[model samples]
Target chain A: MSSTQQTEVGYVVSSRDFLVYLDGLPTIKVNDMVESDTGLRGWVTSTFEDKIEVLMLDEGAIKPKQEFRRLTNRLGINVGDFLLGRAVNSLGVPIDGKGLLSRTKTNLNLELDREALGIESREFIANQFLTGITLIDTLIPLGRGQRELVLGDAHSGKTGFLIDIVVNQKNTGVICVLASIGKPAVVVRNLIDTLRLNKALDYNVIIATSSSEPPPLIFLTPKTAFTIAEYFQKKGKDVLLILDDLGSHAKIYREISLLSNKSPGRESYPGDMFYQHAHLLERAGNFLPEYGGGSITALPVIELSLSDFTTLIPTNLMSMTDGHLLFKAGLRSQGQTPAIDLSLSVSRVGRQTQDQMTNLLSTRVRQVLSAAADLETISRFSLELPPETQLILKRRELIMEILKQDPLTAIPKQIQAILLALPFTTFLQNKNRSFVEKYKVIISEAFLKHPQLIPITKSITKLKTDEELIKLLEAAGAVLAKLCP
Target chain B: MNEILSIILKDTYSLTSLKHRLRILQSYFLKTFFGEIETSVNMPLSPQDSNWLKSLPSSFYQKFNKDNIYNIFSGLEKIGTNTPILTMHLAFELNDTTLSQIGAFTRKTFDSPSLLLDIKVDPNLIAGTALSWKGVYRDYSLRAKLEQKRQELLEEFRKFLR
Candidate 1:
């Protein structure tokens, strides 16, 4: 290691937009870094005969015949717990105006596109990943290492919902990494401010690229975020990764692909679009104890066109993920703040981590909601219905009312279980939607902090059946009844 | 090789010069065959092109018919693709005689007359030359030699500073 280390050099032959083709550096592989004479940086994208293509990572010009030095570093970014509470770009440069990150021994240089662990190194997901959302916890349960797609149309409260999830992970020991790809500057600023205000930034890392950045830099956002997440996950820490939206990521890739002469496939996307995304996402999973025993729960977001999930990108994401949660602008307009369209959403691996009582309750809740939907269609004729049908309809109303939680609120799992079973208790018999809306916060606070109820809440897992839990809740309602009376 | 191909190699001593000749040939074909033509360089042939044509004997023109025109182009293209380029950086620009002298020496040394030279004017070289061949760069310039003795130079400069 002499001070004057001999490095391979390349010369730019042709350039178009952000893509530059070099006629030399015969040994340069894809994703290796190269620095121009003007000090701009680029990542080698592909290698052709006697030439290689590069995507510029910085905001600068690389002219034809300009010289470049091939760096030994492959595609990588710096990582550490010091990255917590800071915002950085794809190159690991701090963008939050927070100067440099504090020096820590945990700092590491991790590859941005490291290969994922194979099935032999992966363990089955055994623990539940909680977002503190009552409806999701009770119905579409998620496992600690599952990759779930969060999808909806624009303005569907998707970002707000994602922020709620991050905020709710406040003290849960789950490290959060949010990759905000090609979002507006204000959105990133507001997100940082919100996280800081909630004190959630202490445990969160944000990798952001604005829409105005170079396409190549924006294209690296999600991969950099995943790299940071992998760092924490390998340290035996649970990580929650949120890719704000991959729709913009796909478009950037398409632009890069079409410019580099890749033939377009369906929807004008490159043929390897699926492989590119799947490769990035496959890095997330639960590792076996022999492989460090940690889990990475990824929520990759995609915005649909006019709520059409049948589009190519959305369907591709759906097929790759364990399940999807479809938010709806229609519901958001109806005042369902952070509106999650329930019927369309599915969770493939979440049910496995749920307790038996929760599994039973979820089945009953689904049955009632399904029957109510079918009966409501028939009841539109103003025909008389049986007493059981009326009770089912009333129960559906109560369930929907209880599930309408405010933004930034994270209800505990025991409280969610107690709240969902309350409709079965005698306490909520005469309660209307307005009544539940007015008292839901007070009820949740009481259940969380009440001296007599904490034991029952703690013992929720011990209760074997949904009826047994409902019975315990009915008894707990006695204390609430005295207070609310 | 055909005499026409051998003729194209004469005075084409650099990649830049070869590219210029290729562009001129393309423009010529565009004007002669296509109804319209557009190139980075304008359609009109310059003195250099005329000089190149004059250097060729009349037998070359008799050989340049439409049927074998592609044979000539494909042959030129093959030479362009295969010829290795050597880049040199010097402190000052060279005169045509100096360039031709340097070109002759390099052509004789490398044993390939068709090899191309890509020269760059770099004032920082300071009275010597830096060369890059096939991406391997070696700086034999006076500046590099001085930089190698930078520590001793700095120690001498410190005496003046004090």
Candidate 2:
């Protein structure tokens, strides 16, 4: 239909905070845009027989009996490559100090909410998505286009770990988009500053909304972030989209739903709460070349309460995503920077993307770690153990120490495999915990430099078994011991 | 319709007319409930209120107690808010005769005798009407016609100027 025939107008009959009930605009559908006389914008959320509910995008001087014009289009935001390295709000307006987004570079306004393409439009997720953290890279890997939930309690290093991933994407050709939804203003600034300090800002896009904005506006931040990521993905560039805490997004939706008088179900959230999150998350996937070919690897963060993963939002997210990586506050306090609980974490798609050698090696590492955990509990009750059991307990402690990496350091896939395999080799028997801590980087650097170890790095691709890879490192014992000493 | 509502229903087809007649009815009821009709020495009703009382059915005398007066005012106020209105924009302000004629035409054509008129004066309409109902607005004004043939009119004006 022509814009003229679709034209409708409404007068505000009643208003409460950011929500206004209009008496006309009978033809306005949900997600349509509306604006008041003074140019305040809103999204049409619910339509009744004679009234429509609009959640205002901005807090303005709106009063009863005010006329609002129906905008011609559904709700959408302008997007472009000019958005990279800049921070923007839910409206696609630049919030960074740099400048405005160049309108010429942007495509026509793209609606934020979109359903995932059908199965025919998608390909298998077969490439590993590295996050520089050795613990996750080896134990709980994630794949391109995978939707992995990064969940943790307060001070569990979730934010720090996410920043490390963005920083590590520096030269990898992967575009990073971080959505800081409903965070404090200072926290958003801190995130941007960390990216800038690492010189990672130029390749990343930050879509942020502070808690003080209107609830509906704050709630649109993740959707806006996804839209910006898709803009880059359309050109077949890989995108790592991080939603830094969807927990706040759920709360904001609950607030809007309750105020709109929708019936609140479990946790007083609206009945469609699961659908709201599931639909947004379903947009991420490895797509076939017919549909952009590139992938959107989404790491949606959720802050848990007291490390309880059984809560409504966390469990709902678990069932929706490919898998989750659980971060813990206790581990953070004990000097584990990323603080991920590998035993609790699972990756359904990442293992498929791993090389045959790395796959076998990680399985070996996990089996050993699991056995050590069981024996440690029993060793505390008894006084002594067999010679092999004692060695196994000692090896587990050394493996844990090697995995406890500092923030902002990214380990390569080969180096991560080599590092995890160190505890199993006899080379680690002589090296003390303090010795390994000081020279681990030196040992890792030797993989590229040392004469004997350099060929092992190339030979890793041909090695079929974890035992062969471990024996190869053990044979280069003189070089490893010299580097550590 | 209640006899009290019917007293002004025929004349009260517009929102402005409905409010004006309801205000008069409210005063007539208030004055009579205070014993103005029986004692004749109570507060005096204005000419409009007195005319309203004269138009009321004689049985209204039996229902003009305190409770009925409240119910009658509440029901009229409810109608004032709930009534569907058709807005008319005209080149000139409406007079009583033109408003009643438009109201009668609309009531018969739309089959809603209780429908209300919300009149707006827009001189730019240039001697024709623009109407809005149920949020849909359309221009049937002379201004709209002139704009529709704007290029032809401009050519004629240019010829005259040359």
Candidate 3:
């Protein structure tokens, strides 16, 4: 092709607020590729009654009447197994400077047909997705293909919680996609480094669009990551996608919409803002067996201001998701590592996914904690309380101490069942605080030595009655007492 | 405003033809103020004008009264200054019939039909056409095809040498 054919020139008429208005190009469509004579690239954002507006892809000086040409190519990226252990931007360009990805590519705007998957194809979510965190695995049991929102105030261990989940999924054969939108470059770099150090990057794909990038690219990061997750899910692999925060994604979208001259509805967000998020999240679910019986369990994080849960984006996500794990700053101040508020956090569908033993253990633990919380509030006013209530409070404190887990140390599901069941047994009641703490360590060490016990605990799913479950728990307790004593 | 200009520019060839059509339209607007513009310029109530009149929506005719017609012309001039007319850059010139055929094709492909074809000769193209419209270029020339298949042709020559 001749040089003239390589470049077809259209004059820019005006420029302002990072948007350039071009005089020519009557055939230009919205989202069409555009480039300036000076090597600046952009996309046609809107076509007014006269001039067309182009959103610049790169920051540079674009002058009036400077010629630009349409590139005629839509934005897309390659997707495949090669993407695992790699870091990419919204366009799937390798931002990690690793190398080129595989040649098998797909469009970024590839539409997932939620209707085609349909309600008829969906199977009941019976299998539990283990996060390996004892507190979460025991209390808020996550079902496969469930979308659970993680809401927390700043510095309340939200990202730490997600990182722990990713770390726990290491050998579980779950492909993890962590999409970070509008985070600072340093934070993103640290996260990638953490994943690398933990060796979790092998089974993970990190999609990072930083805070400094254009709002449009930042807004597209999670959807691009979801598309990548869906690619793996189509192959029948279980995928755990953690969107670090949708609050920033929504803000970036609002910024883009306002810049494009759209009328803002509530809190300066576009009217379709909720639909935009809902549609993206609606792509996640358990598909029918004919469609590969795969699952994508989404843990979309939402940052709160001063522990406020009534914000527009948070409430919208809460309604869309199965349930939320509300992280509390107050709990963090009180030295809770995960900082999760037990009363506020819930898993609506996780109960169906739990086996008999886990359900029984979780119900007993919740009862002790709830009764302790009420008695403690009353004890704040009255120094003297019922002796039984005092014992429940002491037991609740020990349970809380047991749940205070460090980051990157995810307990296996079987070990978690054994450890949680130890507190509910009669042997621990009326025990001194120091003795109970020692007993906790001995129980952990006992399970660590006898890995064979995990299989026995797992096989207890065959137990037909509560009597059988009680007998098994008592037998396990007796074994632990013999080893620890 | 663009719609009116597009209809005027559709079959118009030269600057003289464009001016003539505008004048006829101006007179028609004035006559419609008194009663109705006689249907045609060359002959009153001609079949072409009657057909054109019948082809338009009733709402369009009702809205484009004498006063609004002036606004349409002013709006067209304003649009001409603010928005550049669609231009097609062609590799070579063709006969009027062929040019009209290409013009009609462009009208159907693009949103606007009031396009100006800027013709230039490039003998290097060898036989096929090359055109650029609305900042997008398409090269369908014979030279382009040969360049695309250069590797395959070179392989054939290597086989012959062996």
Candidate 4:
């Protein structure tokens, strides 16, 4: 196909253009040109007062019209899909042969150079974004508006985890922008295919900077993505910006540093590597009351070693973010889908959403897990222990049971609270034997029935009319009293 | 540490190709600056590159004669003059100087014939003026660019796969 010369005729700041480039085309009356290219020789779909938009006909169309018609839907430049395992170039072009992404108003005002909102104007992230995965939704919950760093070694599911978050957010009606930088051609192809299978390409916008591109373009990928997200956010939308991996960004900065003839720091990196990363991660926080209609949640992945976190980049980011979810290669080796090492993972803002379920689960599960973790440490030293120690062991075992979950399992909030409210902690307080023999089954059954008892659970937490609460109690009084009592 | 230094020394042996040699030499200086001195792994320079290194500044030969310089140029086989490479090195004088001052000194003052020396101030090197030219090599830059690239690569590679 022959190439067309595309040029910016004028810079439109808002509605006004400063200067214009007409390419010396013949001029005709605006109304007269509406009929053809001599006037404006393109198909017209619609017209407005200020301007008329038209699709340019291929070079060989016969008898150009004197008047132009605005054909909004008839434009040949359709948007395509780029899903998981797909590769795209810097200009939002599909390099992975996935076809163009499904179009959705491609001509949006996508602007860059956004001024970062001040910290005082930022809101604290408290809401839990439910990922139908039981382990994530119930246990190590991820909070909305939090800057979460997903780190792993090579091929350790860093990109996969980001995709899962985007796919799950579909239910929340959240817009997702997957920004890929310095990614390989083959991997991009795979990502697009995955998105197509999930039919998620329609809801997502992908911006990629391939390894073969210049440093400036690679650096612009994330910024351009944030600009797109800003568009969605301005419309009161929740947007997730996923920087597949930031290592490449750091590399770009290093190249720039070398070219600038700056002194290299440890590992031949620029002295300001940490600052560059911090600047991007800091942009992920939620804007406050003044800015309505949007929040951006960024998941920037960093690859690390089996147990090493002291490396410069990981350590710097660890302190910058609210916290990180460590996806262990060893766990993946054991066939874990998320490969999240719950023992070391945490969400600092997770406890902020204090409805019945979150409160019950976070407090009770944490108590059991913490106690069990300590007891396990002691158990290794001595075979024999106090009676309380045996009880602690039982409690620890129960905590592990709660932690046990299928990777993709999505647990409803009602079930999440019930599992937390179950007297697993009390069971640990009792004699280890009886608790193991009887209490375990009793608590498990209660937890399992939690969803069925949701009417009561909602009533218990609802700060509303008394009649609904009374009706809920009447329906599930026996179970409620039995557990809480 | 020794292995790394040796690798760097070996790489820098092709001194005639200024940039490559500069890159390798900078690697050595950075490690030394960071207290990570590695043993020199000098590769034998080809006769052509060796003759080019030999034709550098008289002071370069005087300070680091054949024996001392051999440790630095063992790996480089040859660097034909036809190539474009930025040969960057630093030279320490008794007085403080800037790049312009050194360049002025070499162009107007220093009596040299075969080696064309370009002097520049690089405070990253401790109390020295940098000598950057094809035939001659010196070091005294405040910092090294190669070290920065290596560090960036290590950091990025660690995160890229994750």
Candidate 5:
């Protein structure tokens, strides 16, 4: 459609916030681009028997009987290597003021029917996508193609967790796509700055629709991000797509639906809300080798209201995703950096992808933590406890301290394995608690610097016996003790 | 000058005579309950459109004597605004025949003879006519045909080259 053509003129019948009901054009599709004579840009959202509702892309004055023309093409974005390290809106227009992206354009709503691909086309997710966070890498290990929901309250380190994962993917060769829907512009800027500071921006693509943007664009951001990720996925490259939070996305959809006169189902959310999110998340999976053997790991964040997991959006996401990393507000207050509640958080398919050594070590850590939690509860009621229980509580304290990692500092999987295995060894046993605490950094540093340990750590995944793991841990402990002493 | 007539041009076959009847009814309504017609017509309906019946003013009940006012607004809502729709399909420029055909189609499509046809051109259609009447869009263009048989055409071209 030529932009110069004055082909179809529609007059606005009624004007609402971000939505205008126009009369005359009856053939607009759900996502057809529409532009007004007064320079207002929008897209057709809903079509009724007689009227069409348009969601404005900008906050321009739309009076009654305003003329609008339907653009011939559907919404699209430029997707290629040019998008890497750049910030763009849902429309793929560069918002970072870095100038226009001159690349081959592709339709934003390219549908990938996973159901038609059949079972044989998809590979078994056997490889681990390490986040470098000890808590996540060990306790809730993520498979390359898994969709994990990160649930937490506001300011509970949810974004920080995702940023850390993206930062860790820097050298790992995973193309990271962060879709910030309805986030403040400043927050998006800060996130981009953080990525640049860590030099991870080279491997990152930031697709953002800020809070001030129209609801339609905000709703389109995540889908656009997924399309970009899919573009790279088809090239046999792994992509990590992080939707910062789906809560705001859901709210934006609800707003658009209400403005379009759609009936609200639960909590005033549109009825198709569940299907809306499920369809987007369903696009992510590990494809077969014939399909380039690529994977798009989606880590969709959901902010909980008062740490309530039973809410409408959270429940819908929980059911759709593989499992969730529940970041507790209480844990955050207690200074647990990631604030992940191990008992509540789980990875349904991650254990299968982990090495036997990691599996063994994580299992032990879980047991110790669970025991400590139980003891803490029991000791709260009683003044005294058994010596073994006391020691378990002490070990838990040290383990918690070890898990307190600085944001964006992603520990290598091998390093995480070594650090986790230390609690089970004689390195901290019988030593003064303070002395062990003080020397913990020295021990980790020593383990990280060992040249022989790198190859041994790589081979640890192949080791079959616990006896071999125990011997290796003992040898590593002896070396660490000598270095830290 | 009636707001209803101005927005309902394309669906004039049924609404043309009804538009005259509504103008009379609207004038009478204004005389009895000044500006109430605008308020009643512009009142927000429930998102589901289920509560629209009950949300009507009680004064409308006494004045209209029957539920004719409700029926009129509901009908008005269905036909939408009277803006004439003209959808044009072109390979490039709007030829004389295509322009005249579109003009004739618009006049015949709507009850209001004064309503102008809205024209939109799609160069992708290659050569054909695509019409948007009332709220429906129909494409009778060669471009659409090419798109439908794109794969077959590609194969045929490849065979011809061989």
Candidate 6:
């Protein structure tokens, strides 16, 4: 219970009177504003038979909780105020060394304990959440109020992709809740450090159940995280909930089953595992419609062996998601970050939920990439192909030259559109030398008008001395400009 | 001869064959009492008198000069008491008159009861025949029980075989 009880030291955030009791010590008055001899005032919030929960709003807060575990001296207990951009444990003690967390007890309750207030958007998906990462923004674009499962083998960049998405959320103004269940303490430490270093922790709320904690407590970690997200959503803020990996959470269910005397199924997993995974993921959908307008976007990660999609965990999530972005292990070995095999990865909601502009850009780029793939496949079949086959191969080589991009870097939408619509189709089709000479000016003029097409234009500009590639770019640019316009 | 017997059993199948065999064997034994054996319309012994003959072993009764066909065979046939059902696994062996009596009893009970009979030969039973009915396996073999008793005592049956 919380009350507006002000003390001489600082403000108290409770409604009911609490007796501060440090076990085996004399009890202090519930309303007393006690202070340490060290000049740090302690504002007590609640007291239990074993421990006292106090908030020290002063500059010099109490020592870390772990250090005081053995001490019997209870000289006015105090913990510093909780602040954003710092890693704190469940008891709201700072774990990351980024100093005490700044806290203001809100009139509203922090833990939203209510069962889902019946999602206002029964089954509606719109208003995409943009993660400024290029490969995702361009290809499998994420939508608000949808659950996407990123499934892959271990060491395939699942956590890396999640971190990238969380970091990129700064641009979209979305609040993030990263819930790590059954993860190592070191992982939580590194994540907190990374978030703080990037200043992304200012918008992030972390809830962790480390491997050393009891299994039952670890099981409730993700649910506690969603409750926090729901609190943000009620205040009309968009929230992103990322379950670092749910496979271990399912292992907790299997442990519960074994403890409860149930027979294990394949791979020692419980028989009712489908329901466990399905219910958890189904909770991640949009709760409030655009009319009332608040959103929760979920990205649940599934780990498999050697990127095998047939594993029970991966298969169950694959069927539940709006789409999946697979990170291939082979690509990761090749020093590729976000090692997505683009040809195999796809978004089901590609054109379905996108604006007309993004769809037009993505479709043209996809077609050019597909064409390049086909030509590359055929050139291997015939060793001694004709001159026309050679010409097709050359055009394909030019397409790859234009499409190659670094995944971590993002290209803006307007630029993405211009690159797809380069007027090189006509020049690549040019046969007569007179037509090549005449249309070369037409292609250059088109590229000069759209700065977005500068990358490909610069490449073709370099190939001006090489007549063949110049002709290819002019032909390709003509075809794309007409199609895109 | 085996083929002829199979064909005859296949065609003229009836309970009368057992009765006919009983009469023929009874006539041979009747020569011990009468000077010559005679095929008679009626049996010399009553049903009550045949009951004692039924208890006698086939080895002891078969050596008698008096007619002993149907008496000994029908005697051992009275061993099994339960009715046969549609699906069952039963085995038969003619060790002494007990085996013949069992065969006759099973034939009468299971003829119209949809039962299957399997015959096996094992001389090592050493005494009374063994019967396995339905799922229950019974061992009336003296040799088997002797082997078990010896095994329980942790002794080999090597001396008992000679």
The candidate with the higher DockQ, 2 or 6, is 2
- Residue A358 C-alpha lDDT in model 3: 75
Instruction: Using TM-score as the measure, name the better of candidate 3 and candidate 4.
Output: 3
lDDT of 3 at A55: 75
- What candidate 1 gets wrong by more than 4 Å, as runs, is A1-6, A102-107, B1-82, B96-98, B142-162
TM-score, candidate 1, is 0.88
Across residues B1-162, which tens digit of lDDT does each residue of candidate 3 receive? 766666656664323335555565566666767554454333455565445445656655565775577787677666544332344334566765776676667666765556544555667788787665555566777777778788899999999999
lDDT preference between candidates 4 and 6, better one: 6
lDDT of 6 by residue, B1-162 (tens): 222223222322223333343444455355445644343324566653345345445765434443544454455233211223221112333343553455456666756322223344556667654444432234555655565576654544455654
- Model 6 Cα interface RMS deviation (Å): 41.2
**Which ten-residue region of model 3 chain A has the weakest summed lDDT?**
A107-116
Question: For residues A206-291, could you state the per-residue lDDT of candidate 5 as single tens digits?
Answer: 99988987787898888888888888898899999999889999999998888777899999999999988998998788998788
lDDT of 6 by residue, A308-412 (tens): 788777777788777888888787776556777778776765346666655655665566567667777777887987766665555444433333344334445
What would the TM-scores of all predictions be? 0.88, 0.90, 0.76, 0.54, 0.75, 0.51
Kindly report the interface RMSD of candidate 3, rounded to 1 decimal.
3.9
Tell me the deviation in Å of residue B8 in model 5: 17
Q: Score the docking of each candidate (DockQ).
A: 0.30, 0.40, 0.24, 0.01, 0.13, 0.00
lDDT (0 to 1) per candidate? 0.85, 0.85, 0.76, 0.54, 0.75, 0.55
Question: Which ranges of candidate 4 are over 4 A from the true structure?
Answer: A1-88, A95-106, A138-140, A334-337, A381-387, A423-485, B1-162
Q: Could you give candidate 2's per-residue lDDT for residues A1-485 as a string of tens digits?
A: 22343347788899988999998777778899998878999998888986889999988989877878888878888887778889999888888777868847536789977666788988899999988888888888889999999999998988888888899998999999999999999999988898989999999999999999999999999999888888788889899999988999999999999999999999998999999899888889898887888899999999999899998999999999999999999988888767988899999999999888889888888887998988988899878698888888888777888898888898887788888888888899856677778888998889978878889888877888888989988898877777665
Sort every candidate by TM-score, greatest first: 2, 1, 3, 5, 4, 6
Clashes of 5: 8
Candidate 1, A361-417: lDDT as tens digits: 888888989999999977777678787887788888888988888898888898888
Clashing pairs for model 3 are: none
Q: Which runs in model 6 stand beyond 4 Å of their true positions?
A: A1-84, A88-94, A97-120, A287-292, A371-375, A384-408, A422-485, B1-162
Clashing pairs in 2: none
Categorize the docking of model 4. incorrect
Between prediction 1 and prediction 5, the one with superior TM-score is 1
